[model samples]
Target: MFKVLLGVSRWNFLSLTVLTIALAAVTARYQGAEIQQLQLGLVLLLALCAHISVNAFNEYFDFRSGLDLLTSRTPFSGGSGTLPQQPAYAGVALLLALVTLLLVIGIGLYLTWQLGGKALWIGIPGVLLLYGYTQYLQRSPLLCLLAPGVGFGVLMFLGALWALGAQLTAGAGVIAVILLLLCSNLLLLNQFPDVEADRQVGRRHLPIVWGLVPSAKLFAAFYLLAYLLLALAVWFGLLPRFCLAMLLTLPVFLLLWQRINKALQHNADLVPALALNVLLVHLCPLLLLLALYWSNTATV
Candidate 1:
């Protein structure tokens, strides 16, 4: 029982669900209401199951690609878990992912029947998005950027919102767009450290495609664009102008940027490499939504 529980990707899987749900509660509260605590719990549980499945399947696929062995694997191979170290059987990991995904599908089907096809539309796209990120577009340049940002961010947010029976408002759209841009840079920030290992393994992420300096610049550009988009969203009144309060996280982002740049300068890629997995796969979404939760709810 304990081992099975441990197989669930602990940090970000929980973090993303918790933070996303918290953000939903805050969003509802800001509109002067509260969601049922029971419904929120169910929504979170469902999201966590989906995240766990995605993480496990990612490990299975990466191992299948032969990227996790022969000195080519990044120390922090995203949130795919310890497959690289052979902590558990690959078939077992895949089994876990399949079981969890099927569970989510069951829950999603019930939700569709309960909430009508509206919820079904979002849930269906969401599962496909997860599969695409792992089995297909994960390595593709244009789509890869959206995997971390939009896939995990906006989609997670929308999942919670849908679970709560909320409609897709302009506010939600704005948040999703902003999150996509931020997540893209966050992904790039993570890739810097693994450039060599990934290159050695034929990973060919943006860091490798553009080389170090250019990659750094590109990553920075995404961060800058994210900020600008946030500003524009505020100015245009899509999201609440006050949502920009999350900008306080800029210092942390700046620090990460500096660390990534310096590591690239030196060939000691360990920090960025490990940090990439830690930050991108786990910490970035956790902290970003966490900050957003507080910022979006605090003044209310």
Candidate 2:
């Protein structure tokens, strides 16, 4: 049951939230701002609950909507395989999702009252995105790209910044936009494999709405945008020069891009690309975290 819960939570992807929070915290440190450990812990707890809520709710909704049965489960795109095998767990998953969402709301309210009302600026949309994405947002082609991107990227990053006692600066704004683009592209690429299943259930994700080839082209463009924006940020002195460490992931990004470019026709062909993309997602933020840490310590 624990293993099933882990699977349903999509624990692997939860690291993205952690990395975003860490990036914000590390950025705070680099800027010589102090973060309350307790506050940071509460922020992380809320993020975890929100992530699990999204995952579990997604599983429950897909199972109810019959999308899970139609999907050919892949290592990446499909809903967790737990529900298709154990249909009885559906109610439990839904309950878990709602309970966690409430916890997130409670924490968010506390953070808002403690930090600033700006927390609501990020929090309200976050709650809506989590609950609506699987049902309503997924049906809107543009939102299918933007919702996850905004929820994980901009909202979480900004929320973390506020929690860490940093005023939202232009640099943080740059990071938020870059993250939004990266995560949006991540969802865009992963949608390719599930296009058929998603279509049957009325999901108009990028790969479906734009056609695979165009979406692939845009995916490639989004990758370049991430790097381009980072370079610009560093050049403009918004981010530290050491942020160039993120360039280390360029080779992996190139490999994934090449795979997507060359063989997008076959789902099998895109698997390695998907895997590489996931690695790049984690690796880029990780490198940024390290860069911030290095910058902080070097100056100290």
Candidate 3:
């Protein structure tokens, strides 16, 4: 049962939340904000619960909608396949979703109480996206494309800044936009292999609405824009020099782009592209986090 719950929640994917939250914390530190250990811990718990709730909800809803059975499971895209295999545990998945959502609400409310109403600016939309993403938002192509990025980049990242009492500096805003582009592209590419399955289930994501080739092109454009923004931010002194470490992934990005183009152009396998997308999604933030921490520790 424990293992099943973990599977339904996509426990391995929760590390993305950890990386995001850590990046926010380090960014706050870089900006000279004093981090409170207790508040940081609560924020981490809140983010984790939010992520778990979304994953479980997605698992239950996809299974209920028959999308789970239809999808060709992949390492990056498709449903987690837990409920399809363990149908009896469908109820458990729903329960876990609800319970985790409630926990998210409780923690969010507490943080709002301590941090003031500004937290709601991030919390309200986060809760909405968490609940509506797999169902309602998935029906709108543009909304579906942008929702994941908004949730992670704007809400989670900026909300962490609020909790840590950090000012929303220009550099942070640039970082947020970079994250937004990366995260949106992350979901965009993952939707490729699941395009047919998602369409059958009435999901109107970019891949479904724009078709794979255009969607692939958009994915490439987004990544290019994100890297350009990163370079601009550093050049303009919005981000530190060490943040340039992210450029080290440029070769990998080029390879990923080639793989994605090949997969789309020649109907080649997409697993490698998907894997590289996930790696970049995680790696970019991780490198930035380390860079921010290093900047904070370095003496001027």
| Candidate with the greatest TM-score versus the true structure | 3
**TM-score, prediction 2:** 0.96
Candidate 3 local lDDT, 44-128, one digit each (tens): 9999999999999999999999999898998787878888889999999999999999999999999989988978888898999
Could you give the C-alpha RMSD of every candidate to the true structure, in order shown?
3.9, 1.9, 1.6
What is the C-alpha lDDT profile of model 1 across 1-300, one tens digit per residue? 345335434344356456556666565554445678787777777777877777777667767776556343443444444665554577777787788888888878877787888776678777887566656765676676567776655767776776675655666665666556665665566565556656665565666777778877777777677667767766876656556765655776677677766676775654554454344433433443454455443222
CA displacement after TM-score superposition, residue 183 of candidate 3 (Å):
1.1
Model 2 gets an lDDT of: 0.84
CA lDDT of each prediction against the hidden true structure:
0.63, 0.84, 0.89
Candidate number that wins on TM-score, 2 or 3? 3
Model 3 lDDT on a 0 to 1 scale: 0.89
Per-residue lDDT tens digits for candidate 2, residues 189-255, read 8888788999998888878888999988887787788889889988988888888898888889888
- Each prediction's total of clashing residue pairs, residues at least 3 apart in sequence or on different chains, is 1, 0, 0
Error of 3 at 74 (Å): 0.9
Model 2: residue 100 alpha-carbon error in angstroms: 0.6
| Candidate 3 segments exceeding 4 Å error | 296-300
Q: Which rank order by TM-score, best down to worst?
A: 3, 2, 1
